[model samples]
Target: MNMTSYEEMFDEYVKSSAAYCASLFEATEYFFKANAALEATIVSTNTAKTSTIHSIQEYFETCKISLIKTIDLLRTFQEIHTTIPGEQVEVDFAQQYFYIKKTLSCVEQIIQLFSTVRDDKNLQQQIWDNDDFTTYFTTSADSISQAIIWQCNFAKRANLDESI
Candidate 1:
């Protein structure tokens, strides 16, 4: 089997997305805290407010969208290797830079999205205002930070060394 540049980058990209999927379950706690806060504020209003579960649903929906995009990117990357078979073809790193960059960008976007959604201060403050805001906030923040750590560690292992 020939290892094309596409295969190399695709493998790395799969690792990136797969790690995100694994960590997302753990990541739910962060959003859960944020959602609890958002629900409190939204529910308190006279008008209909988005429920905590609903917001979480929306978030996972967003994650689904990201997943689709990631899978599509993988398919496109895989396509590059499909045309030729049984030949040891060398893939140029320089040549695949754009696709690799795009994959990296997708990973960054997912990480940033997770960070932002999990740490929306206004919603957090509103949700736990009646309770202990400080502890709630700290714990929630820590969860997001951990997610970032998980992502960064995976990147480092893959020799990407990106601090997501």
Candidate 2:
């Protein structure tokens, strides 16, 4: 509509897009963390990984809610996160980028959001437990770079149109 209104909308879109990116990184981190926790469960009880899995699942939900005001808001604008065919799931990144660039996008967004927050360990731990974010982030940029390379090769072989 108006100039300020446009800026506000652009800002909102950036915030939401950043959130969408944030959730994926959070979920990926949760996946690896849960994987470790699940291993512990298997050794201790030889039982299901239910507790660890549930914990990770809960984290994902918290991430989703924290990322958006409402589910409808998410459905309305998550273009950056693409869906796969057949299952028609709402998700992000190809399997090739699973552990690389795709994951880095999340880490960057979370850091940006958390940078503005102050002294809130509870909130921090809620998205990502403890302070091992740096550990996961150390090689993030490089990994993402590798993913970009793979995506380029894949696109050429598949003869797909350039990504919009």
Candidate 3:
């Protein structure tokens, strides 16, 4: 897809993910409040309150699993193609540069949104603050760097540095 379309998709994905997490948190807060009220009025029903908390925990776990899946889906942004008709396939540096920059911005935003939802300071202190963040940033940066090097070599070999 073109850069504009890719960006639109990325924004939509991030917004949807953030909204989902917000909804989950809101629901969790509501459940906790409800459980608290139950405990206040029905002090003898300890087992039921414990079960309510367990259910809330289970719900959050499921939401986290879903968030991870959507984050993994962001890998599609890096799968751009540069096909050639013959055997000699050259890199499209311009296309790579544009999309790589967009991907980097999207990843940064993703990291910000990812960190806001979680309370663990330890995880927030890590690189990108999410399980896939390190790999995503490193892989994208490496790909962009390689593309730059390859583009420079290609321009030098063709003696078309000015054109590039």
Each prediction's Cα lDDT score?
0.45, 0.44, 0.41
Ranking by TM-score: 2, 1, 3
Candidate that beats the other on TM-score, 2 or 3, i.e. the better one: 2
- Per-residue CA lDDT of model 1 for 11-130, tens digit only, reads 765665565445444334434544464556454534355444345545544544444454454344445444434442333323233432333344344334434444333554543443
Backbone clash total, candidate 2 = 1
Candidates, ranked, lDDT: 1, 2, 3
Which of the two candidates, 1 or 2, achieves a greater TM-score against the reference?
Answer: 2
Candidate 2 error regions (>4 Å): 43-73, 79-164
Candidate with top lDDT is 1
| Cα lDDT for residue 66, candidate 2 | 38
* Residue 109 local lDDT, model 1: 46
lDDT tens digits, residue span 1-164, model 3 = 67887676657655653553354344334433433442342333334333333443343344334334333332332232222122223435456445334434534443454445433224324434465655654554454355345445654643543433
Kindly report which residue stretches of model 1 are placed more than 4 angstroms away from their true locations once superposed. Answer: 1-20, 23-26, 29-33, 36-44, 52-133, 161-164
Considering every candidate listed, which one attains the maximal TM-score? 2
Looking at model 3, residue 106 earns an lDDT score of: 39
Ten residues in sequence with the least summed lDDT for candidate 2: 80-89
Q: Model 2, 71: alpha-carbon shift in Å?
A: 6.4
User: For every model in order, what is the number of clashing pairs?
Assistant: 1, 1, 0
Error of 2 at 77 (Å): 2.5
